[model samples]
Target: MNDKVKALLSILESAGFSHDDLAGTVAELNDAVNDGKSTSIQLVSPGAAARYIKRINDENVFTARFRHSDEPDLLNNESNDERIENPNQDSCIVVSYDPAKQ
Candidate 1:
């Protein structure tokens, strides 16, 4: 696995994504990145990767039950898959959600 795959897997794990569906998600994400649909996620770049991962968890077959409601809307500006570079500044500042309220 390349850095993208590793980053994806790490994000998935942190968000508690479904293990059963990971293999397919990994393959799909990898393909998306390779095919110009999605890009590699960066964990060290001021929460850009983390935000993107949260959005992925909300959508698609591999659902994240504990998904964040206030996830930053970074995808809207993401025409291609690359680090947003301090995404929190360019993105919406949605407030955090309560896990118990969900």
Candidate 2:
């Protein structure tokens, strides 16, 4: 894997994010990079990645796939499961638009 990917994955893992969480986080970060929201081609470093991940997670920036319903049966249902939270929650992954480049 590339340095950016490795760094990002390591950072996420250290911040209590599971492998699946890292996967989604990487996807979102890639999208940001592709969209020109972020200028850097790769994650700065494992330290930088860790800091960013912690910053985002602290901001409670996460998205989930399922919604909870107010039903006693559903609460007890075995099929009920928490949604897979999205990596782009609460603007955790920050993208600062540099006007100097404009």
Candidate 3:
């Protein structure tokens, strides 16, 4: 296996996947590739992948809010518990994981 494949397998193993499961998945993937099908895999940090797994298994949600401004004073005010309404940029995202719902 190439370095990338080896790295992915290692990550999966570390994430508590069984050897037999990995082998079966690899076989299926190989079959797909041989049949001229395209596949895509994303590599992420171990911590991020672990968090994703935990969220999915626990059926949890992750939410985050971000604000951006070119002014230094605005950022400093934000840290002081001041709300900057309608800043230069603001965004909020919510992600929920529930395989059963899918």
Which candidate leads the pack in lDDT? 1
Model 3 segments more than 4 A misplaced: 30-37, 40-102
Report the C-alpha displacement of residue 5, candidate 2, in angstroms.
Answer: 4.0
lDDT of 2 by residue, 1-102 (tens): 444445545645665556764565477655654455533221223223435544433432221112223211222242434432443221233323222343
lDDT for residue 56 in candidate 2, whole number 0-100: 34
CA lDDT scores, all candidates in order: 0.43, 0.39, 0.37
Shift in Å, residue 63, candidate 3: 21
lDDT at 93, model 1: 22
Which candidate would rank higher by lDDT, 2 or 3? Answer: 2
User: What TM-score, over all chains together, does every model reach?
Assistant: 0.34, 0.33, 0.32
- What C-alpha lDDT, on a 0 to 100 scale, does residue 2 get in candidate 1? 49
Best by TM-score: 1
Candidate 1 vs. true structure, TM-score: 0.34
Per-residue CA lDDT of model 3 for 1-102, tens digit only, reads 433334445545665655675675555444444444443322222223444444333432211122223222232344544454543233211122222333
1-102 per-residue lDDT for model 1 (tens digits): 545555646665555545564676466666655554533222222234345545544543222222133443353554344444553344322222222323
| Global local distance difference test of model 1 | 0.43
